[model samples]
Target chain A: MKPQRCVAEGLFEWPSDEPTVSGSRCDSCSFVTFPTQDACPRCGADATTPTQLARTGTLWTWTRQRFQPKNPPYIGTEPANEFQPYGVGFIELPEGRIEARIAGDIDQELRIGMPMELTVVPFATDADGTEVLTYAFRPIEG
Target chain B: MDDVAIIGVGLHPFGRFPGTSAIEMGAKAARLALTDAGITWKDVQFAFAGSYEVDNPDAVVNFLGLTGLPFTDVYNGCATAASALSQAANTIKLGEYDIGMAIGMDKHLPGAFAADPVQYGVPSWYGETGLFLTPKFFAMKIQRYMYDFDITPPTLARVAAKNYRNGARNPNAFRRQELSEEAILQSPMVNDPLTQYMFCSPNEGAAAVVLCRAEIAHQFTAAPIYLKASVVRTRRLGAFEVHSPWVPPERADSPTVDASRAAYEIAGLGPEDVDVVQLQDTDAGAEVIHMAENGFCKDGEQEALLSARGTEIGGSLPINTDGGLISNGEPIGASGLRQIHELVLQLRRAAGDRQVPGTPRVGYSQLYGAPGTAGVAIVST
Candidate 1:
């Protein structure tokens, strides 16, 4: 049987005050995927090992919505079931992969490729007052 | 690439079919394609189906009991149908099978037409998926393009006006009605600068095509339209990951441009060679942007090119002759083939009220999906 890797356990190890990220190193193609997995998304290689990804990445593309999104992504209130603009785009990691998210500034001048860094931020709070934090990439200057 | 011909094309009218499941709608299209090809279910060699929300595998399995043919399912967001056609064409090109079928169908209740953030996941601190809506996401790209090119809402309205006029002739279209510039311009704002009419409504439908090796195309139909080429690509370059300078040298070719270029290369043709082009019209500006990006015009020239009568029905290169997603409605999985089916119909001289004048010797269809996946195919009479 293949060894099991529980995400919950991994999340615990990467908890705040001790930040960590996930990735996979493919033995066959040497391809790596962040938010690590047992197989490579590039070459379909199952020969993979879990590894930690860099805490920082480059901002690939970004846009802010002037409206709100349906189902509310992280923790913003639904804008009356109507449009509430927001921003989102890809963030390229040092490993050459990307992730999407809700953007901060709407009018910030964004280019195609730019240097950025990752930070753990709060998404939304549950009824229990448990503030959930998620990852977001921002301009390094921020 | 081996020669391949489209023996038949079929579609369930594009509109809101909240009453129908994607599988049911897909089956209807598959059955029609089967009949149109003059082939019974038993003669099929292989099949491919596409959908955004349906189970990836069951999309193929559910059809087995209907068409009784072996098949596989594909899911690639909005380009689902086009991807299915590409797979089927590739299978035929490889000589693995002389005949193959591809179908795409979608209903929006489950995943709708936007990319799923849960699938992409939030890193924990970064929350709120408000920017993920289809309109908002595309608006970002459109806004950037508009800012770079000095585009106005009226310029975008021109595309909507054209598509609505074209859709007026499409009996199966959803907003088959007409819209004036003022009406389109005044519609509620889905995305700022992108009015209500500029956006495609949630549509549900399906489309299917029967493909065969070129040499044997005559067996299915004496006048089968040949699928001259197919191209697919993803924008893993500077377009998505980081904010690179929009400078030409630094900015790589967009996925749509790259896919169309590859397709034209494969077909040994250029945009000028294409008599009719059916491109994705999920958003009004999409048609204009694709027209230029697909080589119908130079970059940032779609506004002027289209305004100067370059893309009308009787103009040099008529596009989206069957109304477009704006008029016909964006039917997700069915949209890609719907574009191809329109091109095929035009090539076959079967587009009645919406027909382009003269014999359309060559045609092209394209689809844009999932922020970066672009698929294209060239068809010839």
Candidate 2:
């Protein structure tokens, strides 16, 4: 089974460039939070105008889910037959923090404050094979 | 020492009462407090009520009518009641009022957790995907912490086991069935690394306290406890976007540390002086770190504390003598005040079955909201 889709469905896809992950910039404090907001939680500033996110950022921290998630979360009518553990991490952007799912197994030597780049990958595929894409981070192989 | 006396304390038992509302719970707690104080409702010079959900306007008006008292409402997520405590203390200390009352109450049901969306801007992926639920989000933290600290599943399960064992003896607790560490570990994992038993029960309950001038407390009751220290802090005002490393130096006298320090300074005591404590254990992992952050132990030593049984009723700290949220259940706003209520009982040596040995002189309670919001206080008998 695929992962469960989000309730608030929007046309979210990253454009390849400096601002990789799309998000709104808080006009008041200049703080950036993902999944967009009307006002900046930081300075209580208005973020009416959302700017694209910086694609390239550093990995502040990361963790992986060793098991399946609950309903309204896990994809399909039934649980996945095989659990494929996935890595998730905090990508440090200039505006704020953005967490992304990871693609491909990387070396285990990952450490805090490592440089990373944002990329788009399949978040989950629906029953009809409709692929939903979401942002992901990978080490910027030196 | 300035004698801080609670002339009144009130409570609505922890349980599932679906028909009850947070507003009703708050009012109930306040009404009971008025009676407990042995003073007319009109005697309360100021009032502060703790609530998380803003849906109930009646809660405010009803309490106002019940006592004809003019007061403010405080909301700090799970720390609502504790925040109210600090607010009332500040008001009383300013000589604005001779008597103050604080109440906490919530009526929440079991369901997938969701919070008010980030209305100010586009929500984070967490908000959009609904990954921001407290249990789910904290599960992520627990998973990370386990790996970093090399903590085993049984070690975490021991916390729930200990709380349940004591909770069974408290008539007011939600889940009083004593559970073993194996049972908690075997329960279905809500999120990886966190089991259903490890999560706080969705409960409906209320708790209240009445504060009077320190010097006059003995007149109300021979065993009036004194408030030693109170502190409340919010995430650095404009640091929401700042992550762990980029955050500013915590405010001088920040709410979390500052409140406890003030408590110790005012009481002329330290963490070492505390005989009993009630920590804000909204989540199992939170209890671990909060105990360390609150100076119960050094950072990363909480797992050891659990292993050594140092947090048990007769252990070195005797923290959370009331079974904590994990067993007593969390009614959001009421949780903070409930901790204080627990401390009061322990300090007075009135706790029946789960009482910590000795007449506790100084007791502490610390509550937290999300990552950065926290409140702490120390009380003495």
Candidate 3:
């Protein structure tokens, strides 16, 4: 088995079992942001607190990416020829709505307000044989 | 600020101009506008040029002789033209420059705009994960609107067909062929609710307008159109916008909403006064959403207004009389000016085959850009 790591540092917590994202809460304005910020974007307050985000939430809105995005910016695991459509959505956590890539079948039914849970998945393989991981949301099974 | 008047307008046909460089296109439009205004390039007091890809659109001065004037380059994403025109108008109202020019041009390659997240102050990971694309935001926006407003998929198709119908009549439009609702609906689905046909292509074009103090506009042209308002606004904190990693649950007015509200206030008019309208139809859903955002109708009222053919060229309130971004395609910098061009022609009763029936007294144009910037302009004959 290859060693694994998160795609970006300090984005979320991953035990390879239960994954939860981190966010920043402004002590000045009580504004919250995902992936955690050092300062508040709303009130420009330097005093911020790192808060753990809920792993479960409801779908706010969603769409599919049918075309291959431009390369330099898009470092998706799939090549143009092997590009698979993926679901993109915003999930409504208790604190804030976070934009995220959705995991599972593209053809799967994804309705707004449906239950969803956070998960970590393979993003890309490095030349050093390390597996890069990213966070995603999956529709919780009934 | 005093009211400004558009004395002359010109456009470089929007499409694939293989040999013409963007600077050349911009120069052509500027020269034509100068010719139409009966003024030489030397007569212009100041000029503002808009472009996205072009490093310095102000470089158009090299093509048009260097008169040693204050020329500015503007790049506000899709709302570039609006900023150019607004600055020109404000300059005139300041009593500094009586006559000035606002010109915009861009030659973009085929497909969507490739934007770096860092440029917009968004995280690089947003672009890396492929969620930063503009089309997705439009699709998801209209999709959620459809869900909340009871808009059907066919209604979106109808909006595209209407633009195509208008485009087919306009000789200057890029996609001049009229598509049926069935054809538009059946087109390849790029984003869930928006199909390939529903989205506007990023193409090449140029447009220019010569503006002066409204009091002296009659000296240049017989039918001068008064610029009632020209304004631009950015996103509020709680609004949903492109290139965002997350959004606040609280809803806030979009830039279009803010700009349009300010424009109406400045113009002392409302949607009812607008006889012809040109909106940012980057996609068919955009037109629908803008119909509400610009205060033409309420949020869900489009579901009813569209069904009754209220937005057709001959409808009570004609929209996109010369086709919209859907037909002309989007040349980032030049797009908003194209809307102004259409409004000038319609207000002057000069639009040939696509003219709205009866004399139009007021015309409205709006432009919405990435990272949440919006521009709005109102004109009257």
Candidate 4:
């Protein structure tokens, strides 16, 4: 396998198998937040602890992005001619809802409340030739 | 607390002005406002300038011949002007200053606002993954809203058409041409349900307002619009907004709701008292959602409101009488002040063609923006 690195450190586990997004759960309030929070946003307590978020969830909402985003930060390697529209939305995980780029054929029909599973995807390649990976959600297969 | 009154309002029309620097536009608006209030720049005791693209809105004071007055620069996303206005009003209300000025100006490139995810507490990886879609954020919000409320595409189209029609009557609006509902629907799709014309572009403009304690109002203008309330609030946890990668299942009151509720509480007036209204129409869908958030109507009632022409001028509840950001193009920092300028014009019976009839007594304006910030202002004749 090609050498790969996660887009942002500590956002999600790498290794390309058994992927899980990281989050923070408040011990006092039972509130959860993605990418981890030092302090609970709900109760303002410092009891937030690291937790792996659910890998599957329901599609709460979605929309197709038709325009090419202004890049500097959007380091996707897709050429302008080969660029295709994509879906983006919030997936309602058991821990909490998280926004993600929807992977797979976006032209296919999508509906709210469909089951979705998290998957690691290629974001870009760094100067060191390391594949930068980011997490996305796709409709779970039967 | 002293009652604050807006004695003068001015605008450097909402449109692109390539050669005009933000400072020059801001100075022009300041001069117009000072002239309208029959006061020299020297008489202004305090100033609050709001801007995003403009490096230093306070620098405009040099062009206006500064009188060693206290000037503060503020930036609260798209609610920049509202925050400035709120601060200016509070300065007068607290009896710290008898007369003050609030101005917002910006010169932006033609596109969606260039925002960094890191600036809003999002990880850089969020943007790297191509999840930094502002229009899609709006579309997703309205999509869920539509799913919950059963609102149709035609209703959204009608909202844009109403604003466009109203924009045609306002000489200062950026897009003064009226668009039909059919035309709006047929416009190229931007995000799924939103069309190209349904979203406002980031453009250039400046607006200013001269405010004074109600006791000293007659010294400025014969018609002073009383600032009943001005409030600014940010999103709490679980409130869905632009740039947030995740939201808790439990929803919190949006910033608009929090700000609007506080504004009405302080003003001792409800939505029923508002004769004219201005809402943040960053997109057509935003206007519909905001209508409910601002307490004008309940959720799921937008379709009926749009179909009945209730939000049009001369209707029961005229909204965005000056065409909103949808028609005016959002100049970020100056957008909220532009709404205040319109309300002032309407209250004084100076809004010639786009005037709301029946001696409008009260007006309300709400502006919601990126990274979760909202501002609400209630004014009365």
Q: What is the interface RMSD of candidate 3, in Å?
A: 1.2
When candidate 4 is compared with the true two-chain complex, its DockQ is 0.74
Better of 1 and 4 by TM-score: 4
Candidate 4, pairs of clashing residues? none
Q: After superposition, how far is residue B214 of candidate 2 from its true place, in Å?
A: 0.8
iRMS per model, in Å, is 6.8, 5.6, 1.2, 1.3
Q: Which segments of candidate 2 are over 4 A away from where they belong?
A: A1-19, A22-87, A91-97, A102-117, A122-132, A138-142, B54-67, B120-125, B148-150, B237-267
Give per-residue CA lDDT, model 4, range A55-137, as digits (tens).
99999999988877767567776677776778888999877789988888978778899999999987577777888888889
Ranking by TM-score: 3, 4, 2, 1
Q: Model 3, range A57-91, lDDT digits (tens) per residue? A: 99999999999888657776566798888899989
Clashes of each: 35, 24, 0, 0
Candidate with best TM-score: 3
**Candidate 1 lDDT (Cα, whole model)?**
0.71
Compared to the true structure, candidate 3 yields what TM-score? 0.98
TM-scores for all candidates: the values are 0.77, 0.79, 0.98, 0.97
Query: For residues A19-107, could you state the per-residue lDDT of candidate 1 as single tens digits?
Result: 65566679897776655567665677688987766666555445555444444443554345644444455565556545544345655
Candidates' C-alpha lDDT: 0.71, 0.69, 0.90, 0.90
Candidate 2 has a DockQ of: 0.18
lDDT of 4 at A11: 94
For model 2 chain A, give the 10-residue run with minimal summed lDDT: A3-12
